[model samples]
Target chain A: MNWLKYIGIFVMLLFLQVFLLDNLHWLGLVHPFIYLWAILMLPIELPRWLQMFIGAAIGMVMDLFTHAPGIHMAGCVMAAYLRPLMVAGYVQDIDRMKGAITITAIGMGNYLRLLAVLVVVHHTIVFMLEAFTFSHFGFTLLQIILSSLFSYALILMFEYLRKNT
Target chain B: MRNLLQLILRYSNFLLLLGLEVVAFVFVLRGNKYQQVAAAGAANVVTGSIQLMSDNIASYFRLRADNAQLLEENARLNAEILELLNGQTRKRDVNDTLSTRNREPLSSQEAPYIRADLDYSFIPARVIAFSEDRHHNYITLNKGSRDGVTPDMGVIGKDGIVGVVQSVSTHFSVVAPVIHEGIFISAMIRKNDYMATLHWHAPNTRRAALEDVARHVDVQLGDTIVTSGMSAIFPADVPVGIVSDVSLGEGDSYYDIDVALATDFNSLRTVHILNYTHRAELDSIQ
Candidate 1:
C-alpha cells in the first residue's frame, strides 16, 4: 500500500471539492461532485480494516470542510464495510478479472452494484442526518431520493471518465 | 479462549463501523447547536462575500429601475408642489377666504389610511433573497447587527407586515417570513371583530391562514385582517392580509380561513425593519 499516494489523492480531492465544487450551487441547491468516489474506487486487495479506517478519515475531512459533522464519514465507512459483500456478489471468477477491480474489469453490472449500494447508503445517512429531529419524515425522504439520484449520477459520470481515461 | 479471540477479530470491523457511525450520529444529534453560531458566523462571512459580489451585479441592474422610480416620484412631488403653490397664491388673492374656509367642516370623510407608528431614524435595508420552499422558508436582507437589526426586530413593507429578523451577522440578516411555520402573529379580523392566530401553511408562499377564531363571527369574504398588537413585536392595526375564503365545516372549531397576504414576498425589493424606541421597555414590562 502506497500511503503517500493515497494521502495525496485524498487531500487534492477534498481541497477541490470543498473550495471549488462547494461554492458551485447549480439550480440554487444542487452540486454533487462525489469526489469521495476516489475512496470508494480504491483497490479491493487493500485490507478491509485499512479500507474502513481510510474511509472514516476521508469522511471526517469532508465533514470538517463542509461543517456537516458525521454524515459523510458514516456513509464512507458503510460503503467500505459493505464493499467485499457487494464485490463478492458479482465476481463469479475474480481471477478472470485480472485481480484488479476497475469498472471495465468488473463489467457495468458489477460496477453499478457497487455504485448503487454506496450511493444509497451515503444519501440515506446524509438525508437522515439532516432530518435528525424527525419532525418532517416525508420531506426528509424526498431530499434523500433527490440528492441520492443526483449524487449517483455524478458518481457514474466519474466512473465513465475513469474507464475512458 | 481461541473461539472468543476469533469472534472478536471477525467482528472488529463491524464494531469499528458502529463506533464511527456513533461519532457521526452524535454530531448529527448535536447538529447546529454548539457550533451553530460558529458555523453560521463562518457561513455568514462566505455568504457575505458572495452576497457582496452578487449585490454589485444586482445593484447594477437595479440602478436603472431605481432611477426610473426616482424620476416618477420626482414628477409626482413636482405636481404636488405646483398645486400647493397655486392654492397659496389663490388664498393670498381671495379676500373672501374666511367664508370659503368656514363653509367646509374641520372633520371630513376623506381621512388617510392610518399607518402604525415606527421609528424613522433606523437603518434601511433591501431584500436580497426569498425562499419559495416549504421546509426552510426565509428571506435574506442586506442589513444586519451593525445596522441595528437584532434578532426579533419587526419587519414590514409599505403595504403590511413582512416578517421578523431571525438571525443577524455583520452585514446581512435572515428573516422568518409570516409564511414560515415558525412565526405566529397575534392578529384580528377587522370586519368580523374576532381575534385569532395567523400562521403559514407553507405550501403557498403568498397565502397564510387564520387559526383559533370561532365560527360564530360574521366573517365576510375579502374582509381585511390586521394585527391585534397583543405582542410587542408589531404595532396595533397593522394590515396583515385579506380573507380569501373561510371554511365552514361541520366539526371544526375554528374557521380555516385562507388570507392573501398584503405584502408580496416574491417581489419585495425593499422593506423596513421597524425599531421602535419603546420596544425594549414594553417587552420587559410584559
Candidate 2:
C-alpha cells in the first residue's frame, strides 16, 4: 500500500512539474524545481545502492522531459549518495528515532537539515551542468545560490503544508 | 597499499559521479541540430502558452496604449499621404529595374512602384511574445506561414528594423530580432555614405553597434543611419537609428559607433512584414 502511495506521489509531482510549474521563472533564472520532490521523499530504510539506482531512474526521466541530457541524473545520484551521510550526520543517535520516513515521523529540525543538504547538493550539480564551462565561475555561483534559495523555499513550503494537513 | 585501496573504495561513488557528469557533458556537446531544434521548439511552446495565459490578464492594461499608438501612427501616415498629394514628396521606386534591365530589354524610365501593383499584401501581425534572454532572443508573431509569411522575409516596426523571419507555423512565426546576437543588418551612414554592419550586444536593447566604417569617414553624433539595400531583405533608405557615439577599437582601424535604434522594441506591439516583389527571382539567381 505504501509502495503504491509513493508511485502515486511520484507521478503526480512529475505531471504537475512538467505541465504547470515548468514555465514559472523567478529572478529570470530561478524556477520551481518540483522535480526534486522525487528525491526528497524517498524511503529512509532503502539500501544505499538501491537508493542510488532509483535516484538515477528519476533523474533520467526528468532529463527526458527537460531535454537537459544528464544534468538531473548528476544531481539525483549526488543527492542519493549523500542521503545516508546527511541523515547520519543529522541524527546523532539512531536509537532515539522512531522513523517511518513520514512527514510526522521525522522531527522538523532533522527533516530540515536533510532537506537543506540535499537541496544544496542537487542545485550545485544542476547549475554546474548548465554552466559546463568554468570560464564564468562567478556567474555560475550566483545562479546556483539564487536558484537553490527559491527551490529550497518552495520545497519547505510544501513540506510545511504536508505537516499541517 | 591497503589504505590506498580503502581510499579508492570510499570515494568510488564520487568517481562514478564524475564519470557520469563527463558523459552528460559529451552528450550535450555532441547533441545534433535536430535535438536542438526539438528542445527550442518545446521551450517555445511552453513560453507561448504562458504568454497566452498572461496576455488575457494584461489585455485590458495594454489596450489604451496600443490604441493611442495606432492613432498616432495613422495620423503620421495620413500626413505623409497629404504631402504626396500636394506634389512635394520624392518617393523612391520599389521595383528592381536596374537588375531587370541587365537581364532583358533596356528601359529609360525607372520602374513603377510595385507596392501599388501587388494585389496581395502582408497581414499586419501583433507580437504576442518575445525573449530578451542573452543566448536566444526570438519573437512569436500572431501571424505565420498560413498568412503568406515565409523565412527570409524582413520584419519592420513603426520606427525601424525589427528582424527577419526564422521559422513559421500556421498561426505563428518566430523572428530572430535584431537584438539577438545572431542577427546582423547591413547599415550605412546617411551623411558620408560609409557602410557597415549593425549588431546587438544582447545586454542593451535600445542600442546596437555599427562595424566596418572607415575611420576617415566624416561622422558626428546623431548622424542618421539607414539600411543599405545591399541585401534584398530590407529596402534601401529605411531609417535604422541615429549615431550616439563613435570610437576606435584598440589595435583596429575601423571605427565602432553606438546607434540608438529608432524603434523601441520593449514597447513594440504591431509590426509589418516587408515582402520584396522580386524575391523569387532573386533567390533563383543566388
Candidate 3:
C-alpha cells in the first residue's frame, strides 16, 4: 500500500469530518460520521494493533472537536478491532491485495454490507455510551438506526464517487 | 509459567483490545466526572482557533443579512434617542410635580438614588462557533480573558439576551447559551410587570418556557418578556422574548407561557458581553 496516499486521504477525511459533516445535524437525528472512511479503507494487511491505535487516534481527534472525549475513540477502536473479521468474511484474498481497499475490488453488495455492519456497530456503541443508560432506550435506538443509515448512505456515495473518479 | 505465557500469547490481540478499551474508558469516566477540564480547555483552544478561521470564511456569506440586522438595530436606537430628546422638555415639569407630590423632600444623600444610570459596559465580540442541535448547546466567542471577558458576564446579541459566559481561555470563551437546558433567566411580562422564570426545554432552539407566573396574571399572547434585572448578570429591561402562547390546566396555580426567543441562535454571529462594573460591589454586599 502507498502510505502517502493513505496519509493524504486521512488528512482530507479528517477536515471533511470536522468542518463539514460534524457540523451537520440532519433533523437533529442523523450525524454523518464520514471520517470512518479512513479506518474502513486501510490496507487489509495492516497489523491489528496498528489499526486499533490509528482508530483510537482518529476517534480522539474527533472527540476533541465534538467536545465529547473518548466516546468516538472507544467506538472507533472497537470497529477497528472488528474490521478484520468483517473483511475476512467478504474478501478471501485480502492478503494478496497490494493496494488500499476499494469498493470495486469487492462487489458493491459485499462492500455496502461491510460498511453497514461497521457503521451500525460504531453508531450503536457510540450512541449507547453517549446516552449512558437505558432510560431513553427507544429514542437512543432510533438515533442509532437513523444515524447508521445516514452515515452508510454518505460513505457509500463517497466511495462510489472516489471509485469512479 | 509456560502455560500462562502461552495463554497470554494466544490472546494478545484481545489483551491489546482490553488495554485500549480501558484507556478509552478512563477517558469516558473522567469526562463524565467533569475532571477533564484541562483536556476540554486545550481542545477549546485548538477548536476555537480553527473555528475562528472558518468563521472568517463563513462571515462573508452572511454579510448581507448581518448588515440588514445592524441597520434595523441602528434605526431602532435612533428612534429611541429621538423619543428621549422629545421627552426632555416635559421632564422638568413632571419632575417638579412628582417631587411636590412626594411625602418627603429630596436630600443630598439620596440624590444618587434618583439619578438613573447603568453600570455596565458592552464588549463587542464575534461568535466563532455555535450549536443549537445538542442537548447542551454552547457558543464560543472570539473574546477571552485577555480581552477582559470573565465568567458570569451577560452576553446579548443585537436583538436580545444570548447567554452567560461559562469559561474563558486566553483568546476565547465559551457561553452557556439560552438554548441549553441548564440556563434559566429571571424574566417578566412587559405589559403587567408579572415576573417569571425563563427556561429552555431541551432540543428546541426557537422557543422556551416562562414559568411560575401565577394563573391570575393577565398574560396575553404577544406580550413582550424582558429580563427582570433581579440577577446582577443582566441589567433591567433587556428584551428576552415575546409570549407566543399561554396555557393553564385545571387546578394549576402557575400559567405555562411559551416565548419565541428574540435572539435567533441559528443566525447569531456577533454579540456583546455585558460587563457590570458594580458586580463585585453588589456581590460583596449580598
TM-score of model number 2: 0.65
Under CAPRI classification, how is model 3 graded? Answer: acceptable
Docking class of 2: incorrect
Could you give the interface RMSD of candidate 3 in angstroms?
2.2
lDDT of 1 by residue, A1-165 (tens): 366775676667765665455545343334454766766666677777887887887776565444445767777888788876677778785434333355776778877877877877877776566445576666666656766778788778866775787
lDDT of 3 by residue, A1-165 (tens): 588988898889888877777667666667778888888778778878888998899889887776657788999999889888777777767567545556877777888788888899999878876656675577778888988888888888989899889
lDDT of 2 by residue, A42-127 (tens): 77677666777788888766765454456677788888778766666656654454323444655678777777778888988776
lDDT score, residue A36, model 1?
Answer: 61
Query: lDDT tens digits, residues B1-286, model 1?
Result: 9999999899987888888788877765553342332334446555555555655666686788868755865676566558757875787688545444332221111111223233322446887655544333567788988888888777877568888877778888777778766578889988756788998763467788888888777887899999887766776677899999888899977788989999877666777776766777877887
Ten consecutive residues with minimal summed lDDT in candidate 2 chain A? A94-103
- lDDT agreement of model 2 with the native: 0.68
Chain B TM, per prediction: 0.73, 0.75, 0.77
Off by over 4 Å in 2: A1-165, B1-36, B40-50, B88-121, B249-251
Number of the predicted model whose DockQ against the real structure is largest: 3
> Which has the better DockQ: candidate 1, or candidate 2?
1
**Candidates, DockQ:** 0.29, 0.22, 0.48
